[model samples]
Target chain A: MPSLKDVKTKIGGVKKTSQITKAMNMVAAAKLRGAQSKMEAFRPYAEQFHAAMASLSAGTGGARFPLMEVREVKKVELVVVTSDRGLCGSFNANILKVANRAVAELEAAGKKVSLVCVGKKARNFFRKSGKMRKDYIDIMGTFQMFNARAIAQDAAANFLSGEADEVRLIYGRFHSVALQRPEQTTILPIKPIEGEAGGAAAPASQAVYIYEPSQEEIMEVLLPMFLNVMVYHSMLEVSASEHAARMTAMDNATRACKDIINNLTLIYNKTRQAGITSELMDIVGGAEALKG
Target chain B: MAALIQLEIVTPKGAVLSEQVEMVTAPGYAGVFGVLANHAPLLSTIKIGNLVYKKDGRDDIVMVSGGFCEVSNNKVTFLVESAERGSDIDVDRALRAKERAEKRLAEAMAQKEKIDRVRAEAALQRALARLKAAGKM
Candidate 1:
């Protein structure tokens, strides 16, 4: 049996640990709010970009844009986005798992797969593999649109230069605070927005548009902008999802720590009571012997 | 006929403005143009300059960097890299930016650096647009 002093020391250690976890839980909650607001703020920009692209592409009348050309798939670049820091309970691991699975699947199909890791966790995970085309490290905490623009530009360059025939992005999609799932999307070879023809059937959509400079010039700018929007959207999603995952994980840790502290406290109280009872029994026995 | 059009100025950060306005005059790549209610469908790339819209006969100026504007269905949407209202422009910040860009340009000219010269020129243009929008230029 452990001594009462030892039990007390253990209880103190557990209490300190619980306090740290509780503090971490609160920090995560606050950070989650900021990240979620950032995600909400980006939606308007993305929506406006899409609406502009839809109308522009509808007027193009099947002009062959270089970014839209689909070529034979010889090489694939997987852009995996994850959190820069860990302790978020399987958030990074799930993304890496999905990414690895994609790489394996692509390799099995007789295509070369290269990685474009977007966070430190992904960089470290794929560091030893030697298949990295590029690894962007330590940008999650303060990522901006320029960061996404840079990544998209690199991916576009690779595709245009024939280094990679295709590019795909994998990120954790935030559905709610309690749910996030890994999602993959193809960002390259910019597909013509589906339902373009159907939209023209509407009466209001049939109006002729006066294009400035020219349609082709606007399209030339629009396609690249579309790619940038795709990358930026994914980055925003990953940022929000990371925070939610961390909040939930920290909350669970705090609760578990509380339960541990409760159990330890119960044991400490019992041990102290037992010591008091034994001392009382010894005093009573000594008094009875004196009376005899 | 409706006398007002919906004007929305959106950046990657968020929508800066979304309200009904009497008219909008933007700095288009082709040239500066105005849009009223029921204007024809149009799409144009914009430059770094001041944008003005009249609401209740009050002209509200906004500064926008290079982006595009789409006019459709009585709506004018500007998707720019960044934007700021005339009232939101911090004169001190704009002044500092102008000074920094000027210094960079001077240094680039002395060293004959083409890339630095180009970036500095763009920065100078943005700062000038901000000042011009605030009517301090």
Candidate 2:
């Protein structure tokens, strides 16, 4: 049993902790709004890019694009994105779980797997596993588009160089503060839609466009741009998701701390009352003895 | 028929412009090209240059870094790596950026480093595009 003084000290410490947690919660909440809006603003551009790519791939002429070439998977590169910090509950764990499962599945199928970790949490997790081939630790905190571009360029170069046969991105998809889903998406060899009329079947009603430059040259330039944009959008999504997860986690933590402080305060009060009553009882007994 | 054509300009950050327009002029990789309503389905690579559109008889300009353009179903879309509207371009800042890129390009050339030269050239091109869109070039 703790003494009254000890209990009082514990209560004071808990109160201080609760206050700090509350402050952290408020700060996370403030950051969350900005991150969420940034994510929302970028959604339309990503969606339209995907739509345009889908439509183009559906056309007959898409066969001419080298990126449309589907090859046998031999080696795979996994681009895993996680939070730089670990205070957010389960966000990093969820992404790592998905990535681990993917790696296991790929290895089981007799394929070589490499990891390109984007954040400190991912780097640490994969480094412990002894599986990460490329780790980008410096660029995780800033979450800039140029950083994403550089990473995407590196991955694309590796794929084009035949260092990796396929490239996949594993990330946490942000839906809401209450919902984050881990997803794995294939990034390379751009999958073509099945049963779509080829681009050669241009609508007869539409006028024929004369290409000033060759079509082949246009595709060569566009493919890299598409890859860079996709990577940048993914980074944005992951950043927003991290902020949302942190906000929710900190809020819950602050509430929990408050509850603990309240319970400790109650214990401290009870202990103090017991100490005062025992002292009073001793004084009255001593006075009665003296009267006797 | 001259039906209004849908034009959308998008960058990695987000969609910057999405509206119906009378016409659009883009800096194609080969040269500048103009598009009208009912234009045939086409896909072309774009260069770092000015993009102009006429909407409700008002001319609007945008600076676009190199990317791709696609037209289908009377909708024209520009998937640029980066884009900034002319109205949003700060003249002083753009001038500074241009000078910086020029200096970097000269230094890279002097050092005889192809990679750095190429990067500096791209920066220069982006700055030039902004200036062109702002009507300062």
Candidate 3:
């Protein structure tokens, strides 16, 4: 059994650790608030872009753009976005798990798969497994639209040059502070919804738009922009989710540390009381023996 | 009497301005273009420069980077890469940025790097736009 002094020292160390975790939790909470606001600020732009695309696709004949071309799925490139840093609970692991599942499914179907990891964590995770073809790091914390544009351009160039058969983006979608779900979305070869092509009759009335440039020209410009914006938005979501997850994890760790400290304090008190009682009993017995 | 036009200026960050205005003058790709109420439907790429909007007999200036402008149905929308209101722009910072871009441009030319030169030129334009909007140029 450990001595009381050792237990007391351990309790002190645990108390210090709990203090540190509590500080970290507060910092994470502050950062999470900032990230969440940023994510919210980006939502309007994404929604507007999507609405514009939906309206445009509804107005024009479907599959008129090269990007809308559905090709055979022989090779798939997955762009997995995760945080560069860790300590954010399972934020990175969940994304990797989803990507692994995707890889397995693709491989089973005799399709080759390549990875375009966007963060250090994802890059490092897949690098050891020799699964990543290319990786970008150190951009998640300070993400910018230019970064997204460059990445989207590279992916588009690869797809256009027939280097990859298809492109899909996998990332964690932030639903709330308590919930984030892994999502996989197709990035290339825009798919039109059903009953909307060739002026097909649908439940809702389709509005006609006067395309300034040809539909093909608009698509040529808009498709890449759409992809970049979508990717940027996803990055923002992941950032917010990471902060949220970190805040929650740190809070839980801090609480656990506190509980441990409390238990240790109780044990230390009991042991100290037992030692004092035993010393008193020895003194009384010595006095009684003297009297005898 | 001129009709009221709904003008919205949006950046990647968020919507900067959305209000009814009397007129708007924006720096177009070709040149500076002014739009009033009942203007024809037009779509054009915008260059890095000042955007002046007249609302309620007051003129509000905003510095904008390259993006696009769409005018349709008497509503004008400027989707800019980045924008800052005239009141928000810092004149000293703009001057410093301008000087930095100029120095970078010279260095790029000396090094014979076309990409660096292009980026420096863009930075210079953006800085100049901010200064002009702030009435420092």
Candidate 4:
């Protein structure tokens, strides 16, 4: 049988664990708010960028930009974004699994697969897996747009130089504090959207635009800008999702710790009561024997 | 027709300016140009310079780096690489940036390397824009 002191020590240890987990949960919650706001603020920029592109392409006589060229899939580059640290439950694991599956699927189709890992977790995994083109680690300690721009520039350079014919991004999309879903989006070789009318000279909006320099010049600048917007949005989403995942994971740990402490406290109290009762019974038996 | 147009200057960080303005004059790559309400639907790439806007008979200055601007339906949106308000800019920081860019340019010229000229020129423009906006130049 365990002694009363042993039960007491176990309860103390469990209580300490509860405190630590509770602190971690609070910290994660604070970080989540900042990340979520950053993600929210980026939506307007992305939407505006898309709207601009839509009207620009329509107004530009629908000339095919170089980034929008569709070519046979010879080589593909997968830009995988994962968390730098691990305490966030299955956040990193889930994203890494999906990325690996994508790579495998692409390879099976006879297309060469290369990775541009944006986080430490992804870098480590791809380093072991084989054929990692670039690993961007420890750059996202704080979310910055220039970081996104740098990555987008590399991806665009690869596509333009024919080093990689196709480019895709994989990251976790934040839905709410309780839910985050891993998502994949193709960014290279821009997909042509259906103009308002079916290949008509003028779109339905029919908004005749007067180009300052020329229509072609605007598209040339906007295409790469659009790519940068996409990458920045993805980075913000992943950052928010990581914080949310960490918050949920820490919350669960805190609850589990509380339950453990409760159980340990019950055992400790019962053990102490039993010890007290045994001492009283021994004293009573001795007094009764002396009276006899 | 609205006398004023909604001008929103947006950067990667967030929206720097979103207000109804009487007019907006930005530094276009072709040259400096002004936009008013009911302007034609147009798109132009802007260079690093001061973007001036008028509101309530008062003028506001914003510094924007290279980006694009879209005008449609009485609204002008500036999708810039970076932007800062004249009131928010630190003059000393802009001066320091100017010095750093000039030094980099001189070094590149000395080494016979054309690689950093483009970047150095851009940096110089950005610093000058900030200085001009802050009224330090």
TM-score of each: 0.91, 0.87, 0.86, 0.93
Candidate 2 residue A34 Cα shift, in angstroms, is 2.3
- Per-residue alpha-carbon lDDT of candidate 3 for residues B1-137, written as tens digits (9 for 90 to 100): 45799998877788999999999999885688889997776655678899999988899999998766777778888776688999999999999999999999999999999879999999999999899999887
Q: Lowest lDDT 10-mer window, candidate 4 chain A?
A: A193-202
| Superior candidate under DockQ, 2 versus 3 | 2
Query: After superposition, which runs of candidate 1 have C-alpha atoms over 4 Å from their true positions?
Result: A196-204, A280-292, B102-121
DockQ of each: 0.75, 0.48, 0.34, 0.70
Model 1 agreement with the true structure over A126-224: per-residue lDDT tens digits? 999999989898777775777887898889989999999889999999999899999999988888774445685632664677889798899887788
Give the Cα-based TM-score of candidate 2 against the true structure: 0.87
List model 4 lDDT by residue over A142-247, tens digit each. 8777788889988999999999999999999888889998999999998754444544644644557767678788888878878888888888888888888998
Report, for candidate 4, the interface RMSD: 1.3
Largest DockQ belongs to which candidate?
1
Off by over 4 Å in 2: A61-68, A104-110, A128-131, A138-143, A193-217, B1-6, B19-22, B55-58, B72-75, B110-112
Ranking by lDDT: 1, 4, 3, 2
TM-score rank, highest first?
4, 1, 2, 3
Residues A94-115 of candidate 2: C-alpha lDDT, one tens digit per residue: 9999999999999999999999
Candidate 3 regions exceeding 4 Å error are: A193-215, B27-33, B39-47, B90-128, B131-137
Clash pairs (backbone) in predicted model 1:
none
When sorted by DockQ, best at the front, the candidate numbers are 1, 4, 2, 3
